[model samples]
Target: MSSEVVRFEASEEFARRMDAEDSLRSFREEFLFPVHDGEPAIYFVGNSLGLQPRKAKTYVLEALEDWEKLGVEGHFRGTRPWMPYHEMLTEQTARLVGAHPIEVVVMNTLSVNLHLMMVSFYQPTRERPKILMEAGAFPSDQYAVASQVRFHGYDPDKDILRLAPREGEETLRTEDILDTIERHGREIALVLLGNVNYLTGQAFDMAAITRAAHKQGCRVGFDLAHGAGNLQLSLHDDGPDFAVWCSYKYLNGGPGTLGGVFVHERHAHNKALPRFAGWWGHDKQTRFQMGPDFEPIPGAEGWLLSNPPIFQLAALRASLELFDRATMPALRRKSDRLTAYLEFLLDRLPPGVVRITTPRDPKQRGAQLSLRFSKDPRRLLEKLNSAGVHCDFRSPDIIRAAPAPLYNSFHDVYRFVGVLERHARD
Candidate 1:
């Protein structure tokens, strides 16, 4: 249902009724929630760390059992062998980000994958030596980009271009982004952006940005840390050189789990491309031969620098099964409605008590709603936690509350708003 057609009511009965009518409500039972008092806490922090999936333990145990029984032989003997285990995630990971299986691979952590991608794609020359990125990006990304530029013997202050929102604006305008690319395209060797900005919950026009960057002979990539499971992405159609994301947040892969990478199919068989190689990324047919030369496997797997952690892969596999069953289209549909309902309820608060930093249009965001409070946001966060509303506080004032459609119900959103209302009144 579109937001314009449905008029939302702010009563407890309304919230329960919506939850009752939800098609995806059963999926909520699959996850384990944190307890507040005796009841399940109102979990709206999926944008940070997602709740653990109940099946994760079972999956991990299967791996452990195999390891104990077969030892080194488990590499080739188990139901899901350790040797080609990462391949098991390729198709599902591709579907999640809308890419070909050949283009996707499950491997190292997000930053590690990001640095690997930059090594090949961020080939800065004397004429075009700059890296373009969003201002106020996540600190990790800022540090990564700065260090990359410095490693190439370029001064980050001189070579890195950080784009910011206009004066007094909380989010970026798409037109301005395109204009900047048009003007600076010649000097930029690469353009890296968060597919969805972590702070303001702003989703960018990635396709447009990619096209603009390509027109200027610049390679483009995205950090999908907030976008992967939360947004319905079309990375292949969008035509970015590469993209990377972690599985711990919206993906529910447990804490500090594995990450994924997408490399466009056009570059799949380019063995001459410079990369940090490892034995695992070698061609399967001759990998056991222990050849001195690295005959890199075609596509995204070719970028792997080491063998992955099997336990983390097992944990992520459990969540990917849920995603495959739930489907991004269905999840995205419910996410829009849930976020709209949250916005409607937040709008009812007294003027100047709070301001939403996220875009009002659902097209421009994911499940997260960033709330900027007029009062002590940290104190309010403490009250919300005490009252069984679980969310996260960013520095200064913003509180990011994400109602994950796979687990969070409309009633959860309602109860959360009720707590915020009481605190605002106080």
Candidate 2:
């Protein structure tokens, strides 16, 4: 279908009516929004900085109070203490990724966790030391991979392999990925890919990619920064060796928060595996003994470098509790409908004015829609910002807008589309 062919009157009044009837409408009131021109700004930036949950403050305050009262004894003294804090959240996060509690652990930031995972899984023999990743991975991940290869005394410029979309294709096809893995399997030590690409919102096929990599004796890992809370992950069934994700984007854990890393159960008992560790990763019983030698714990916790920030965990705990209520299936249903509605409205725009670059199939994407304006990208973004319709612009051409189902209603999307059409037309 063409942009000019679709019919829908996306207007403020229409949006308000939709909100009034939406089942998830009440959630919009729970998040803090940017104020522009003395009114709450439309927040389409959840893919970058998720809107803060009201309960986040309460959770952090409780942790603060615990710190104030318990002091040095706070490790086991408070209600949600320093001890066993991250473990408390493992089960819920595992459910989000469809894995066992032993397979998942919330730990350091995404890049850090990726580095730690690489230490264990990216063991490259001289014959097969090259690491394979997307061509335009988020800069942080690129840096982590390069630094890791360098740390191993290998030159990243020659050893790192990059996979780009085929000529003239904006997004990569699944067949190309499988072909690359099969062709280079023996020389490829690891395949680290994004579950949902950050720029194009193209969701990759995890199960197939894992299978192809495994067939060639190459281990696989995923950088799920955009996938974690937005899509249903078959982490256990797909069986990647390891994976990492940030909580702040879709998990609503707060800025620069700790994140999750998954180590498949098969690797859980591999005591011979190489790992960079900390006192927390030591046997909890022997940790306080302050021994000279380090014995690692089993599973994901064995990769921990230190105890995580409890304040961040507190926020994650509250957010995961909400997930337990909404469940992935319920949120996905709303995501599909709301995003389709947004696409329908945007398609009503003038021909060639706005293009929906995100995949059309509901099964191929998450909640985000990335748009390309044939006009000046910066001007279009500023125009929306001035109109009180908040959205984000990825440099060059694409603007990413996410109608988060947990707190975003159908009307918010309707209003955003209405504002976009008016501005793009005027």
Candidate 3:
């Protein structure tokens, strides 16, 4: 091994032994490995930035080749024409999220789509203008909702209701969430929460929670940024009014790629909803008529504000193809086993220094486990980095490690644990 440094150590033999029996081990070959100073690093950060799929290069090159060969005609006439390009991705993405085709649209960035969905759905009234969300939400979402409240002429400090975990708890519980919804539903205009929390790998009960929120007449939406590729989420069956997710993370799309949105079909036909519109959202057939009368397509496409970034969508297509090959259910099975194995291995470590903050139940979390280190988390993360285990560190004290089923193996988890054990001892 070319060792610039060895901050922590794992037996290569154990790593290989685990890899030998891993059912998902072959998937590691499908991603382009990350190298530091010409040596491939152990990447455990799929929860943050997913490794590039092997097909990504081809997908992006095809788009570029089409652009070169067709010039301006590429918009409508080239191979995989830009027209209806997003549609090429929608069907597979819809399947992954368990949504109907008409209800899902692949477009826009995650936070932008959330804002767009809220623009139409979050109509605060005199008696019920407050919005409800979990505390410790991803920072971008917190900023978005706070800005949304201010934009609507409501004081966010007064109107934004945050549901925090009970005293001495690391994650929110289902019973508590239901209670909070019942208590604030009367005054709440909307409920928007993470499907799988980013900092803590907590997967909320979507169907039951949606029913509860709707019962109290509060509109509900989800920030599925961490949920989409990490779990088998059903946006349609679960009945959230809307949901949004980024493609870059577990979706394995390139960095800062465009994202997808789901607006339940019930709301798609409602032309009365307020929104920020653009020309691309106009009727496809009559769009070139150039008249100011905007007739929207009869689906989620109505909410789209602009033609998509072709290059970004190309990257997404590569990732989606891999998802199709592996399929969500099959991937979820591997995810459960992989995370369980990770947990089992972690359990073997001396407990007090590193306690798992994520739920023990398989159904309540995705492939990720948020391990909380009682000591200085940043310092631990630094040692982890120096050791070449690339899991992400969420601020204060959580290290979020995701054994992404698409490209991670049981051996990776095994190897990571060995390094972590050394870090703990030091």
Q: Using lDDT as the measure, which candidate wins?
A: 1
Q: For candidate 1, which ten residues in a row score worst on lDDT? A: 1-10
Residue-pair clashes, model 3: 0
Predicted candidate 1 versus true structure: per-residue lDDT over 82-141, tens digit per residue? 988988999999999999999999989999999999999999999999999998799999
TM-score of each: 0.98, 0.94, 0.94
lDDT of 3 by residue, 133-216 (tens): 988889999999999999889998999999888899888999989998998899999999998999889999999889999999
After superposition, candidate 2 runs with Cα above 4 Å error: 1-23, 36-39
Total clashes, candidate 2?
Answer: 0
The deviation in Å at residue 375 for candidate 2 is 1.1
